[model samples]
Target: MSRNIEIEFKNIVTEEEFQLLLRTFHISKKQFFSQKNHYFDTKDFALKKLGSALRIREKQEQYELTLKKPADIGLLEINDVINQTEANMLMNHSVFPSGEVKDELHKMKFPIDEFFLYGTLQTDRAETEYKNGLLVFDHSFYLGKEDFELEYETIDRDKGEQFFNELLEKLNIKIRYADNKISRLFKVIQGKKES
Candidate 1:
């Protein structure tokens, strides 16, 4: 199984300072994780919506199934299948829900356009923290819920492809393309005001 590694930080710097930070990291604003493939982009209002979602505490495990068209983004997902007890139990074993069992129960269809940027950290257990009004998840953290707060942007397919390639190079992270599905934890927020 492939591991994901990432960290979320509050954007406290000015635009120029932020640019400088990107240079230091050898990345760009576009290289930051966002719902780039969705119909929304990271705008002020969208960020508010996402922030609201981030404030909730509905925990569960997540599962994702990616596609090919959007080179960097996943095309489909099956998220939040495990509870806390189950997660703890399955940590050391390769446990997957049976397809026949899922097929027996009619579940909601996976949202197609939704996309997320996820990276793991080096730890045995993942961690989640609410820092400076942002919900930050450490690499090993997985809550079995889907509280994705994001906006989408529209880009020409060619441009989007190029952007993904550049991002891979800038981050120095190997890019993997797959139609396989995976699991993680989820946390959903109800109606909440922005901080």
Candidate 2:
């Protein structure tokens, strides 16, 4: 299994400051990538607001599966739909979803009420940090309603472990043991209340 280091904060930076900090961190706009927009004329299954979804994400020659549920957002239950799409990148290293891969998977056109964008920072590994309600994957980050974000991740297990240790030393965040089980950021967000 791949290893990862994740950190979440209360978003201490303003939108402008956050954008500046990303640049200071040497992040660039070119790294951002978007999935092909598709409208599904017919869905195999009618997606529900409170149901679970199994998602398989393919990125940078790697693949990961994630199981996710809807967030506490009201309305048409778009959070779960967005979560399933976001879970692929979060489960794999923080690389953006491959347009080609998304295209290959979406065989038929479907109605899309919303669109999602993601980016990655690759350095032997990746780190996805969530701050100020924005999911910053590596260098490129995006903000949207009902969307999910991931913090740092490493494809190399050893490097990931090192990053995790470093983060623990530097920040007062909690680390969850990474197991080959279903996982998602919403779970962490919801679980943080007890910790």
Candidate 3:
């Protein structure tokens, strides 16, 4: 198991803006990779209510389960590597694997057994180092909806925000509301249910 603090600034961007950034940054198509996030939550969204999220990320034939909780600075991400069998069990049977992630859920009083696969979000992503931060470009598709996003991840909050904002200004992109991927997916799912 591993733990880390994630501090990042994000902005939802238009397709035109996304393309512009790619060209400006000299990011080739070959730099992009695909990853899938399989989100999980209870029927009542207990984890979401607590401002936490859980997902098993699939990339390069490997799986990692991560639980994100609010932290003083950013979000505390607890991750555990799991094999294909373990990943399948959790997704197919709602079985919580024995690890730090499950233990954390227990501490939060979440009914882990009730957790089920919420949905999946797939992203074609590329990353580069920019101004002492990790800059990310994502074109994601989920639930029949597609969007582009720019993310800057850094340990320094103030500097990261400055760089992120300046990049947006340079690109002529307005700052817009950009929810995290899980939250975006949940909103679409909830909207579908309501409709």
All candidates' lDDT scores?
0.26, 0.33, 0.95
List where candidate 1 sits over 4 angstroms from the true fold.
1-21, 24-74, 92-157, 165-195
66-184 per-residue lDDT for model 3 (tens digits): 99999999899999999999999999999888999999998888878899999999999999999988999999999999999999999999989998999899889999989999999
Of 2 and 3, the candidate ranking higher by lDDT: 3
- In what order do the candidates fall by TM-score, top score first? 3, 2, 1
Which candidate, 2 or 3, has the higher TM-score?
A: 3
Enumerate clash totals for all models, in the order shown: 28, 10, 0
Question: In model 2, what is the error at residue 90, expressed in angstroms?
Answer: 23
Candidate 1 C-alpha lDDT tens digits along 1-195: 122221212112233433343455454334343221111112232322322111111222332221211114322222333344433332323232334222322232322123222222121211222212222211122223222111112233344445444544564534443211121221121112222
Worst 10 residues of 2 by lDDT: 73-82
lDDT of 2: 0.33
Looking at model 2, residue 92 earns an lDDT score of 39
User: Which candidate should be chosen as best, given TM-score against the real structure?
Assistant: 3
